[model samples]
Target: MAGLSAMEKKLAEYKCNTNEAIQLKLVRFPEDLEDDSTTFNPEYSHQVFGDDEVAFGFKGLKILLYYNAGNLSTLFRIEYTSKVNENFDCVEADDVESKIRKIIPPGFCTSTDDFVSLLEKEVNFKPFGTLLHTYSVHNEEAGEDITYQIYQADMTCPGFRDYHERLQTFLMWFIETASFIDVDDERWNYFLVFEKYNKDGATLFATVGYMTVYNYYVYPDKTRPRVSQMLILPPFQGEGHGAQLFETVHRYYMSSPTVLDITAEDPSDNYVKLRDFVLVKLCQDLHCFLPEKLMQGFSQEMLTEAQQKLKINKQHTRRVYEILRLRATDMGDPEQSKGYRLDVKKRLIGPYKKKQRELAKMRRCLRPEELTNQLNQIDLNMQHEQLEESFQQLVSDYRRVLERLAQA
Candidate 1:
């Protein structure tokens, strides 16, 4: 038993955290090759590594996946101080390289010298689509305004489909549950953002990030465009690129008469905050959401105007209304704060109220034994506690939205 315990301790030394081991870089210049500032780590590795996101039987592992910022031509390399192999006999190292190969597409350069050579071709690589909007953001580090352009592209565009395959690879590292979409589907719409820069007296564009929307057919004629994926690469995040990208996409859909509404597929918490900020900013300018109307409470007028003008659906409009309403509410006044809390709680209680109605009907129709089982599932006192908890959480989220809105 003592020997076995000693062997286990020896094996534990071989483990490496995959998240730290994986290093990504978007190389724009030769100097960036040696710059640590250009490197960013993946937010997640569980999808590539195991759920624990650890690689077994490797000591001091570093997986470098670097790409040309303009064309995203990749260079893949792995370095390790020690790896468990036949010498261990009782243990084997994880097949780290093979797992990474499955995510990165074919035709990637494995040689550093060869990869550096590919950067020369980036000067000729231009963004592939019609430019929809152009804007500049102040880069604090650079101390100058950097221009970015958002473009609308599809599979039909020449070379875009191939470029997108390379682009989507970043999603795996950044998004927790990211998956590639079927570019073969004609209904998919792609919105890409690129940084337009002047390189060697010639203009060049570098990939910032992208979004994919799937237009699902709504009953008779309209289509509901659901945002399937949105990713602003790690390097470009916290600079307001996401808000610009989201607003641009939302406005693009708002102009289309056939678009029923805009929605998102399982939005992350960060995405929700982005959406709220954008929606509130958009609605703030609308007459229906003016302070006078907002103070009157959420109305059918607000819903209709938002849906008709902005292509925002009912549920989203209601949430936006509550956020805007909270902004207009005077929290220091006891009467005003109570009204705001009760109004939000009423919306929060909707699901429970629905279940209660179902329970009442079940009491009338279900067998006594069935009703007893159903009654056991719900406790009114517990629900009241839950309702209060939900209301508090929602108010907290609303305040955050208001805070961001104030900054905007």
Candidate 2:
């Protein structure tokens, strides 16, 4: 983002996968409302920050996307309301895609391909800039597959059932290394678990965890890929599998032909040690320097404390979101719903007004809408620490814009 020109920034998008759009529709998550009349409108949902990989919709309705990991790329899963009598393969996937579009907002994407292309255009922000859509698989530079089998991906979508056990096996292996490497579907991002299949029938070996990237709204595509998680099975530990997997993933990026800018969080010494070992030492071995950025008011000590506080706040906010989502779901009971809506309004209003004052005091120049967004973010994360994080991201972005512009 800092390296991009002011002009190039406008055309930049953080949304990856221009190969083809895989759009699905459903109701909004107790999230901001969607055009309910639209089919396949999985645009709305009712999930909290760290909840199940849930997709809420009728049978067959979903939001879908295709992603490439190494040499493998596949159309991924989506959670939705369903009662499929037969196995997933027994169902026609395209028919399900069609049905979802009819039920959610936008009345079903006119064409999945067309809609995805446009969505990529709109969601053009990322925290860091990397050539996202250009992922390639190179066996020449890739690592030898590890000798472990995985169970499942731990998601509750229909089509993935057959592969569930292996996905779970993979996760079990992952938990052996890192306690938290499961998917966070609400964000449409995941920590990948790579695997290998045996010669005859069973699973063989697996790579522990994969790092995911998110669009932090600070980059051109309104997104950035951050190393959100890591993993390595206990049995596979000390044998250097972690280093092998790390090297494999890093090698893919090294071959990116362009510097792949990435970031990760490591409040614990073990992780910092791992990052230094894999990201820095190894990248330097590749003749590349791991660029460093020091954030104000954030350090190893603060990060661990922040992690605990985030869990608490996330649960609290999840309840609020859930209640609001229930109100949206049970519209049949408006009188009962009114109280919840009013409470949300009351909870949100005061903060925006307060944020308006805070921003007014801090910076002389701000657009009304931008200020409103900042205030609303502050309102959303009302707790002290949450609000501070919200502010750090927001103000840092504001400062970056000025800095980038000055450099230009």
Candidate 3:
């Protein structure tokens, strides 16, 4: 046991945290190559590294992947103080390079000088597809208004497929459970955001973030556009880029006569919040969602108007109504607060009601002995507790939406 403890202590020194060891940078100029401010780390490495996200057999590890800001031409390098080799015969070092090579495309520059040379060509790289919208955001830190543009792009666009290959590599880092989509499918639509800046008296563009939507055919003639993936790089996050990207995409589909509604595939909490904010903002302006109408409770007219005006589906329209209703409610008034809580709790009880109906059917169909087992599975008091918990959690989420709406 003493000898085993000594060997274990020695081995621990070789393990490196993959998330910390990896360094990512988006280089805009030659000077940015050495600027520490340009660097950011990946939020996830488990897809490349294992569940623990550790790289073994390196004492001081630095896995550098730098990309040109405009075209995303990459530079890959690995540095370390010491590495485990044949001398540590009992344990094998993690093959970090091979795993990364599979994800990062071929033809990446291996030297800093080569990467700098690629930056010069960035001036010629222009955003692909038809430019749809342009907006400027005030960067408090830079003390200047920065301009951004959103473009509707597709795989058919010139040079976009190759650019997308490099761009989609970011999904692996930023989005959990992200996988490469079939760009070959004509149904996939791409929306991209880029920062338009003037360098050397000429306009140059840098990639900020992008989103992908896949259109599924609805019955008869309409189509349903489902947002599949969205990502805002670390440097550009917290500046309303995500909201802009999402809203732009939503509006783009709104103008189409054949679009049924917009939805998302396995949306994260952040995405859901963004969606709620956008939907409420859009619905709040409509005549059907006036304060008096919201106070009256959700109506078919509200649902019809939301679907017709914004292409919002029934489920989302109901949610938007709840949020708008919460905004109109006066929590200070006991009567109004009670009405609002009951209204929301009614919706929250839907799943439990569904289960109860199923349980009733089982009771009629199953034998007494089988019914006993089923009855034992559910506790009525616990069900009430869960319903109250869900209702509270929902109100908390709605309040957050209202706060952001106020700020907006």
TM-score of model 3 (CA atoms): 0.96
lDDT of 3 by residue, 1-408 (tens): 999999989889999998889899988888987888888998889999988989999899999999898889999999999888745876888888999998988989999999998899999999999898899999888899999999999988888998898898898888879899988899999999999888899899999999999999999999999999999988999999998998899999999999989999999999999999999988899999999999999899998999988999999999999999988999899999999989988888888898899999998899999998988877789989998888888889999999988998
TM-score of each prediction: 0.95, 0.27, 0.96
TM-score of candidate 1 relative to the true fold = 0.95
Whole-model alpha-carbon lDDT for candidate 3: 0.91
Off by over 4 Å in 1: 362-377
Error of 2 at 117 (Å): 44
Q: What would the per-residue lDDT of candidate 2 be over residues 1-408, giving only the tens digit for each residue?
A: 565575234323212221112242221111212333322211222211012223222343444532111111123344445533342233222233443333222322334354344333322211121222212222333454333321222245443323322223222212322333334444424334444433234333223344443323434443323455555533234544454444444444344322224345443444444433443233221111111211111134322322232211222222223222332334357764454344434444566667668877745677777777666765544655554565445334333433432342
Which candidate wins on TM-score?
3
- Give the per-residue Cα lDDT of candidate 1 at 289: 91
User: Highest lDDT among the candidates is held by which one?
Assistant: 3
1 or 2, which is superior by TM-score? Answer: 1
What's the TM for model 2? 0.27
Itemize residue pairs with steric clashes in candidate 1: none
Query: Residue by residue across 225-309, what tens digits does model 1's lDDT show?
Result: 9999999988888899999999999999999999989999999999999999999999988999988888778899988999999
Query: Which residue pairs collide in model 3, if any?
Result: none
lDDT of 1 at 260: 86
Candidate 3 residues lying further than 4 Å off, grouped into runs, are 365-373
